[model samples]
Target: MSAWRWLVTITRDSRSFFFTFATLCGVVPGVIGYGVMQVTNSTNPELEARLRKSARPETVMMGKVNQERLAEYLGELKQKQDTNDRYVAALRGETLTRKPYQRIQPVPKPSDTVTTKAQ
Candidate 1:
């Protein structure tokens, strides 16, 4: 039988169609990606170790800066940390400011008389 005929024969019911499509769409891509990653990551450990030993720790550090640039970097880091702290505090129900005074509706005095509409 042809490919289309074979697919139809295999997926005869909704359950079969669901299972087949799920396997093709989900499992197949996952297996392919895993295989690709394994092949790409297959390397000589000695080469990796040599390369690591050749590189300087400061050079490998993220956004490595000298003393001249340290102040600016620290200021930015502090600002970000403060903002994140405020956000976390707000999440914890800590009020940053006091609530504003609300206006109250005036109540009628007890001495006020009620009038009936009946004539």
Candidate 2:
């Protein structure tokens, strides 16, 4: 009949103890948080005005095509294709030609020096 005795009895069974613990720790807090969120949630007038303004027909317009960006993207695709071709050539044991845009310069090896003294 006492709360302490009821808790002791519930803890004796694993299934009842698990369900009681889950209900108390998980389900109870989740329900309380949902209730609090619902009570506290309210629409802001300024946000509503901004949303209405953005949703107006005058604020919407057709996207303009950028010719420069399109040209740059095409150039990038061509460069990528050229790089893949170079890689394929290298894999086939063929010499790869450097692109005009690339500024790679080969470094020259230092010559060996030898000195002999007359006895």
Candidate 3:
């Protein structure tokens, strides 16, 4: 048999067309995805640069001018804590390690496997 015929026989007789086609569909789109990403990156070089810069996690904010604002905020927070009484410990310059306001959820666990135990 010819190569094409051989491929058809092996693929079809084994009912692997869906598997191969599905795999190709997934892989081809992934390969195509990189190309799309490249095209998009090239098209928006400035945006890409901004995104690259932003991708780094920020621990601290910028501008010394904002310090006064922070103090004001802290003062207001202090007053609020005084009124609340529950959070007085927090306002006393004691650092409060906290859960993030908006956090990325944990990655999902891998799925269970489908097994074949032929008797």
Candidate that would win on TM-score: 1
Q: Which lDDT tens digits does candidate 3 get at residues 1-119?
A: 59978877778777678588769979999999999888866657898678667763442244333675577558758777432432453465333222446222343445545333332
Q: Count the backbone clashes (under 3 Å) in each candidate.
A: 0, 0, 0
Error in Å for residue 45 of model 3: 7.9
List CA RMSD, all candidates. 20.2, 17.6, 20.3
Model 1 misplacement above 4 A = 1-13, 53-59, 63-119
Q: Please, what is the TM-score per model?
A: 0.36, 0.30, 0.27
What local lDDT score does residue 75 receive in model 1, on the 0 to 100 scale? Answer: 65
* Model 2 lDDT per residue over 1-119, tens place: 69978777777767877688868989889999999999987688998778767774644432123454456447758777444654455566554223556523334344444323321
Error of 2 at 80 (Å): 27
Residue pairs clashing, model 1 = none
Residue 113 accuracy (lDDT) in model 3: 55
What lDDT, from 0 to 1, does candidate 3 have?
A: 0.59
Cα-based lDDT for every prediction: 0.62, 0.62, 0.59
lDDT, residue 19, candidate 2: 81
Question: What tens-digit string does per-residue lDDT give for candidate 1 at 1-119?
Answer: 69978777667756778697878989889999999999988489998888877888876573345542466447658777443544555576553322226222233444534443332
Flag the better candidate by TM-score, 1 or 2.
1
Candidates 1 and 3 compared: the better one by TM-score is 1
